[model samples]
Target: MTPSAIILIVLGLAAIGYVLGRQRALKTAQREGVKLHSLSGYHGQSVALFIAVPALFLLAAWLFLQPVLIESSVSGRIPQSAIPEGGARSLVMFDVRRIAEGLNQIVAGGDVSENDLADMRADVTDVRARLAEVGVALGSDVSPIVLQTAKEYRATDLTASFVRNIAVLVVALGFGAWALARIRPGLRARNISETFIKALLMGSSLVAILTTVGIVGSLLFESISFFNMYPAKEFFLSTTWNPQFRGGSELGILPLLWGTLYVSFVALALAVPLGLMIAIYLAEYAGSRLRSYAKPAIEVLAGIPTIVYGLFALITVGPFLRDWIAQPLGLGSSSSSVMTAGLVMGIMLIPFISSLSDDIINSVPQAMRDGSYGLGATKSETIKQVILPAALPGIVGAFLLAASRAIGETMIVVMGAGASAQLDLNPFEAMTTITVKIVSQLTGDTEFASPETLVAFALGLTLFVFTLGLNILALYIVRKYREQYE
Candidate 1:
């Protein structure tokens, strides 16, 4: 049976056990002529947890370990000479897995009978041509060693899956019966359920923490490799950004960082005031009817994909800015410029700031506004003095969030702002951000041994630090102000 089907069967038995456990609890209480200690459902839930949790954990562990064990067992069977020049042993194993899976597909379709497959030989059956008929493409003729190893891989995996199914079912049923036998009226089923829930919550929290740690560790590892190949000081200090795959390429973060900051600054310059005012008008002045229609309309901008925004900037805004403003003013006449991407990105960020600030402003107490009115302050004055101060922490967080988004933007910067790394301050001049440069450096057929390719990781790590700092500062400000208000 399939692993998924086996899991479903185990769960079905557990569900039956729950019903029996609940009935048993009720019967024991009635027979003893006493009130139950806890609800009948808790007793049933305890039985279900005992039945399902251990078995499900086993299933998960089996699934995780099965591939590793199969790879180890199968790869050891092939001769070391089977690996081609400039290729890894793992690459040969990859082909083994693909071929094994493809052969299974053919057998399942009845194109190859079980008896024929058991007696098959690559030399006699023309294995490559047969595999092709089954839609499995191979680069070259299948070798005898590879075919034999693939057949073993398929058989071993099948046997292991069968064993796993039996083991899981046995554990599920065994623990389920034991739990049912232990279900007395005085059993602390409620406490058991609560403990189970708490452990599940902790496991979920750890998954998130582990995910962050894993990301940082990968970046740090690759960045270290990059630094070993290229000097760390020059990577950070040199002003030019030229990457030559041949060798001795001038790779520096300064120009990309400058362009990123410059574009972000222009974005914030346009976004902050407009988004803030929109939030203010929606939260403070607009009626419920107007806000209902307007808020969703504005939020619709956030739903539109960034690629669409890039297209808008490339076709509409870039040309409009270059022809009318840049050329007319004798500034740089490039259609793709810092100004074009910044303006488009700012428009994209408007909904984020406006939505967040609106919520923060609405959270301010009515009593504070009333107190300001009692002091003969006008509505605008009350909003500025009483409401804004209270919402300042959340507002600052909103702005920082927008800034992170702008710094990390790729599509708009790639298409709207041309891919030239420059430290110039002129907004009309073409420039590229850290993200765009990362894409450019990593694209196409390349070897990871070169500094040209590895430098992308160094660039990524630096960008990660900058955005992480922005988020941390934003959170700190929000917490400090919240504590002060409370």
Candidate 2:
């Protein structure tokens, strides 16, 4: 508690001191007789920033590095005879921590000791007592080199903290003084700030760009390996999709692609109208009270973990759909089928599509609806004619996004969609999706250097390309339509 409070106080003082100092610096820079190149506020900001940044960075570094330095020094002090070579460093560090803790425990409770426990206990007490002293002896004689290393490390750390604090003060005073002297009528404070902000934005964007490049590079290398094993034509054109490499297996994609498309289409068919209607009702018809109660209820679906949804689809929804809906309509088998996975996926997508569509529908100008109303148009007529047309492009954008989400969905399909890649139109029959196959290929005992494992990369590349294209299209339509309306 004492250490924590001290740290908190130091941090609080630094921040408050920076802000107050900055304000004073600004006032000093803005004085009548001062010759300045930058604004008074900029000079103040420079002072405050310097006062805060360097000292805070030093404090953070010390807090982290101190523990590691102490541990390493203690490990070096432990004799080679006490602990062996390979495990020596780790054992010394562990025992160092335990030895101190055990002595603290001994102070509280006189516990039984192992061999040489009294000596170990004394050593711990000595180390703790000497820890604060600049170059004090550890009563039990350690090697001269170890003692010198510990002393040097402590001195270096103290020196670093002192220098860092000085640097902070110097930077704060120097920047404040410089900015005060530089301030003038022609200074461009806003442009300088904007340039700094732009550099930060570019740095952030580079992180994302690098991550995307890495993913693409990984997929490209694996896909190239896969293409070399089996001809690209056979992979794309062959009707069969059995990926088992037991005896020089046949690797085809048509069956998997068919299953993927069938499940996606089924999900879209279930999701689109239901999601659209809910969006319309929420946006145009629902009272504010009802919307407040209902909107979050619908969104709650999104928050439910995907694993739970997968279980629900497997244990509850799948059986229910199979027995009640599919079996009744003579469409699907007992539990696992394309319809089960698709229906569950559709339920998952409803909140996503409805939420986006509702926002777009609401964004259609109220004046457009008013004009239609002024022409003696009914609520339904106004919505059907004026509102829907205006919001259509955005709605399309939302649907495309939902489609991409459904395509990429893994858990529900893995649990409910059967692991059989078959080229059949029967909705009741079991089917496998690209994601399920990817999981199957990679999981359990599997060789990395095989065409079977590599196929997952090819599928991943396809999925990435497809989603990328969809996103680009959606963004273009949304942007163009937004411009039109604006």
**Which one is best on TM-score?**
1
Candidate 2 per-residue lDDT over residues 1-486, each given as its tens digit: 223553554455555554654455455546655655565455445444444444455556656676687666656665666554555457445544543443334433535343333344333445444333423323334333333344444444445555655554465445544544554434554455456557657867987998899999999999999888878898788888876657476767888888888888898999889989999999999999999888899999888877787898899878887888878988866688888888888888899889999999998988899899999999999989899999999999998998898888889898888899889888888898888888888883556768888888998988889888999999998888898766
Please identify model 2 stretches exceeding 4 Å from their true place. Answer: 1-33, 39-194, 245-247, 325-334
Q: Which ten residues in a row have the lowest lDDT in candidate 1?
A: 477-486
Alpha-carbon deviation at 140 in model 2, angstroms: 36
lDDT of each residue in 1-486, candidate 1, tens digit only: 888898898789889988988999999999988777789999999889888888998998899899999899889988988989998888899989888988898898887787788788878888888888888988888888888899999999989999999999999999999999988888888998899888878978988999999999998999999999999999999999988757879998999999999999998999989999999999999999999999999999999999999999999999999999999999987999999999999999999999999998998889999999999999999999999989999999999989988999999999999999989989999999999988987893567668888788888999999999999998898777667646
Q: Check candidate 2 and list the clashing pairs.
A: 36-182, 36-183, 36-184, 37-182, 37-183, 37-184, 38-183, 332-428
Score candidate 2 by TM-score against the native.
0.67
Which 10 successive residues of model 2 have the least lDDT summed?
130-139
